[model samples]
Target chain A: MVTLIQRILRGNPTLFFVYVILFVFFVFAASTAPQFRTVYNISNLLRQAVAFGIVGIGQTIVILSGGIDLSVGSLISLAACLTSGIMIGNPTLVFPIVFLVLGIGVLVGLTNGTLVAYLRVPPFIATLAMSAILQGSVLLYTKKPVGGVTRGFMFFANGQLGAIPFAFVFWVILLSFFLFLLRRTGLGLHVYAIGGNQEIARLSGIRVSVAKVAVYVISGFMAALTGLFLASRLGIGDPLMGQGFELESITAVLIGGTSLAGGKGGIEGTIAGVLIIALINNILNLLGVSGFWQWIIKGIVVIVVVAAYKVKE
Target chain B: MLVALFVVAGIVSPIFYRPQNIFNVLQQASALGVVSVGQTLVILSGGIDLSIASIMATSCVFAAALMAGKNSMVIPITLFCLAIGALAGFLNGIITTRRNAPPFIVTLGTALIFQGIRFVYTKGAPFGSIPSWLRFLGRGGIGFVPASVIIFLFLALVMEAILQRSAYGRKIYAVGDNKVAALYSGINVPNIILSVYALSGIFAAFGGLVLAGYLGFGDNWAGKGYELDAIAAVVVGGTSLAGGEGGMGGTVVGVLLITILSNIVLLAGLPYQFQQIVKGLVVAAAVIFYSFVKVSGERR
Candidate 1:
């Protein structure tokens, strides 16, 4: 039991930092605002975390396989636009629209995968270029925001089950799926093998390129889901809706103890990381810091957290 | 050559390659070229400074806030903004090199923080006025060229010299090429990385000022999406994003390529959507060719 405890402590210590930050934020939130304990407020926070958490799942897969996806945000915007068109037109279309959105997401992911795997394009540049294309496409397709009677979509999106938001359920479902994929399957082991040593994985016949493609596709799917979620929540789809989400999703993944170098993260850490970020955003709101100052603080913390994690490693 | 494509367009339309149009291309490229200089430095060291856009945005906001007048605060505040940018980069370096974070993650985190700071300062909406004294810097020019463009060129040349001709430049290449080998040679690799990022920060901040001045106003999003553009420019210019190779000269070409394409596409009356498709194809093609060249060269 002692050895197991030590193993847990030694194997992953980012949780400690997360705990500390969580504690600090909790106290800060309580002290700064008397209404920090409202059920509505707490649910709001979880719902918000759902966005980053779900997207981070896809991000985690890509990062675990030694890649990054900057195009996730733009994918989100596109997905939201596509799905909203169908769902807002009639509630009956929601189910079909979800698949359509996912399909679009998969296509985007495959494009990224093809470039990274077959052509050997650098992940950063490839995804970055993809993002630009996606953003520009979003702007060109829908010149302005698409607003209508999206109450059905928004109702389902914002609905809560026993204080757990509907989006939170979606996040949980994704987490369960990825967790299974990462633990029970040969694919999981192969991802680790590739991330740790690409040449050896290829030698082992792990189909490294296919794996790379799969992860990016998963990322695209998640990004699309998030975009759709944002649309449902916003009751409209804005062309520039997911403008800076690439940075945020990437940040969450990093903060979750996933190494940007790839092959070094997990779902649990990502969940924690998402909450940590959500908490930070909530506290900033509570503190009423200038949005600019809040940005500065978040940047400093991310830099510091990443640096600290590396130092320990 | 893409130049042939440009020439064909010029032939098809008489004013396509006119001096005025080409100058417009140069003007557009100038701002990105300035920021790309810094990006070039960080990449050369095998580090990615993703927070560059945030730093640029921060500088834009601060510079606009300080555009109260050409009082004693002008020069000092300008210096302060530059220093802050360099300092932000320094912070990025410490985490990346000293603290052991991947440069990508460290910068990514800082990018968020800086973005938040911009939002907070502006309170979801930032409105400001540029002082009359600095209007010339932002709008006026010496003869025909924009003062901003001139500054962009000057910075690019200076940075190119520093990267290619200077001892520090050599060190940066050495570290990027092989940190273990560099450290064995007793090079302070971490310090060098820090310095390069710091320098990158300064360039980003400088670019922010140019962006603000040229636009004659500043906002939290002034440099929005610029980091990606600068990165694309550097890569298209034939600078290996892998580091330890390429320089400002190539980046200049890349920036010009993008700027010119942006202009020419508009001139061709291609809608923005098709223009994006074209841009993506061009970048995709560039990446494929670049990969082919690098991969083949490595084999040989």
Candidate 2:
């Protein structure tokens, strides 16, 4: 057991922190709240996890490329704003409408990629500008929340298959596919190479720019899916719904053990990280910690985790 | 040419430079300008402080609670906010300098954490009433020169003197432009990074104070999107996002340009949402065009 533990810690910079947090939260939850142990709460946690878990995948991809994309949350908000108010509720449009929402996501991602990849504009500036554009565009589309998405849309957000929420299933399947792609393919290798060292990757014949654009495209697609689920579940999509999800997604990715400087992250780590964050939120709420301190504690956790990694390095 | 555009804007709408509206713009812009000033320093040091919005919001809540709570404890909270801001900035430095964490990611992570901290303060709603005196700082002017603008002017001069004449400032530029060369020349890169974040924090806290003063009432929502505005203003003002180019003057112009653009939007009676769209377009255009110009200049 000691050797195995040492192996895990040696392999992952964030393993120790994640272990401590997960173990503590589990113990606390089990001891203090008997209700937390039930299958119902476990499913509920999975359900909550799926929402951010999906978005966290995209954020990890982008961050793994040595860049941060602030525009994902805005993209989610815009996708929600576009789909929820009219199409799902109108009953007039076909699946073509969902295509339109997804199409919009691609366009947004493409714009970000083109500017950053082609124009030599910094990723931070390009995404930040795009976020502002999406935020405004969403406001223009709907001043407030719109209540409607096709009844069929609910299948993605709240439906259950053999007791598992469809959302959780979708989240898992999506993540598994990406995990495979990350480890088994040339695309994954290129992404890691670029993130680890862009200049060397360029020297090594990797199309560093293309990988970056691809990352944002993946980010945009996931954000769109996240928005779709929220719309399906809430039965209403507010233009402002995605205001903080960007940070949340990024935090989950970081907590999952991905290096911020890029090139050294994986989807598998993010899964654990997402679970850690989701569990932390649940435990904190259960502990009756005020919302204010919830933030303080969350910040402290991220700092400690990252700081620990730094010290270890 | 940009100066002439400003001239034309003033002519297109007399309100563009009206004393009252100008005061309003200056007061409203002070907080962002303060944060941008800090960002300018960091960017020059080849770093970016993405947490300015969070730092500003944290300070905003701290100041609001003080003024509204009217507790003699206001000073400590203010200092506390300032100290916290510096620590946050210093933390960014430590990650970047010691752990060799990239400033971009360090600040980005801290920014996310800071957002949560701000959310906790209000949980949704901000605290405290704008004291009359503080409110005056936000809305009133002294002898026709607004207090916020005066503070902005004072800050600009101080920043200018430091950036141009101070050895510390010279070291920052050297570190930013090329760290390896600077290190060979005996510059302490990590210490410079540390001081940059500290100064950035100080400036950001000052901006938060101006924000609290001008805008009465505090909530977790304060400075929701100011970081983008700041980066936009900083970049538009001709400060290179690449670092080692431009200074406080460029940021001032950037702030002024955004101010004019917003004033024109309001003058047109367009919805505020449109203002955001316009800001987005303007930032993209400015950055893209500025780079285009720089490239052409290089070719020349």
Candidate 3:
């Protein structure tokens, strides 16, 4: 058993351990809470994980390219603010507003990428500035929550087909698409290469700048998507919507085994990471723990998970 | 450029020349100025401390909780708050250095932890006014000079002298410039990094003290979002984000510049929202401007 465990550890250091811990937590939660065994709760858990999971996908791409996007949460707020502010329960405005939000996402992503790839600004600093700008703009636009979400918008988030929520379906679709892109595409290969060694990747004839730029653009789009879903669910656009989401996504990515320095890890790990977080949150809510305590627990979990990986290394 | 800004402020709003306004700017700048000093040191050592705001917030809450509106509790409560801040920094440094973790993530995590503690302690609502002494430190002036400004200037000068003339200061720069090279030269790189983070925590705590005093009370919401302001000031001061290329003098100028710009915006009667946009733009522009200058210099 020891030898088998050692072999599995050698084969993939990050994935297996995090998975085991996740499985353990799942079992523990399932046993402790009777509601945890219900189909309703399971679907709810998956639904809760969707947004962070989606954002985590984008974060995985960026981290794989040796960059981080702190602006994602703010992008989410921007998307929520813009979409709900414009749509205002008008079904006719939905399509145009969606396009506008995506366009803004692309624009912000392009600017972020250009700063990092072309101007040599550190990814953290560039995205930090971008986040500040996005957040400040959103706050400037609306000092309070703007309500006017359409029934259709709410349905998009809260609706389900048969036994499954649309959110879960959306998360699955995003998961499959990104997993394929990361595992099967040339762009994914180059991303890993650049993250592993930027100079080597450049010397090896990869268009490092293009890959970096593309990843950030994808990240922005995903964040916008998350924002849209968030607005739909809340039935309002809040300037503070998606506050601290960047950290949450990063925590999920890190828990999933993605390295901050980049090159290693993928979406599968992030999916599991998101599930772990969702489960913990679910359990806390079930136990009636306060949000403040939840924060402490989440913070400690991040440190512990990171430290665990460090120990293995 | 800073002088130009001051002159522009005078031209734009006659209130800018008012003694009260000047004192307000000075007092306002001092809180940020103290935090920026420690941020400069942390960045100088090739590290970033995202927890400064959290530390400040936590210290403010801690001090307030302990004092519970009592004057005699001031000194002891202040020391306790500072100690907690230092302890938090020490933990951050240890985790980052020993585990080879990214300073950003580690500090980010620690920030959450500190924030969590504060929230749990305050239960989302903090009460208790500050002591009269602290209130004076926060708001009172001796003659035309604000007490906060005096404290800020005194700390800034001391830090500047240390960074210039102290051996420890040079070691910090050396470590930041190139850790491997510094390690080889036996400059104790880890300790320097650790101490810088500790100092950042202490300074942020001090800043929180001033802020608490300024408000004359403590609240859970105090010191929220000051991290970006401090970082913006440091960067605008011409300090490289990559570290090892800035000083306290530059940070002071950056702090003043930010304060004055906000003052101008307010004096010009712009909405508060514009200030956020401007701050975001200023940080981005400052970094871009510096990077372009560096690129041109390299080519030459």
The CA lDDT of each predicted structure is 0.78, 0.78, 0.88
- The top-ranked prediction according to DockQ is 3
- Candidate 2 lDDT, A1-313, residue by residue in tens: 9998888778874656666777787788889987788888878788778878988998888888877788988888888877876675666663766788788877788788888877888887788888898898888888888768877776778788998888888888898899987888888888899888899999999998888888888888888888887888787788888876886787788777788778876887788788878887877776788776766676666556666556222
For candidate 3, the docking band is medium
True-contact fraction per candidate equals 0.76, 0.44, 0.53
Leading candidate by lDDT: 3
RMSD per prediction, one decimal?
A: 3.1, 3.2, 1.9
Arrange candidates, best lDDT first.
3, 2, 1
TM-score of chain B of each: 0.90, 0.91, 0.97
- lDDT digits (tens) for residues A121-179 of candidate 1: 88877887798788788877777776442567786569877767878887788799899
lDDT-best of 1 and 3: 3
In candidate 3 the C-alpha lDDT for residue A58 amounts to 92
Highest-TM-score candidate: 3
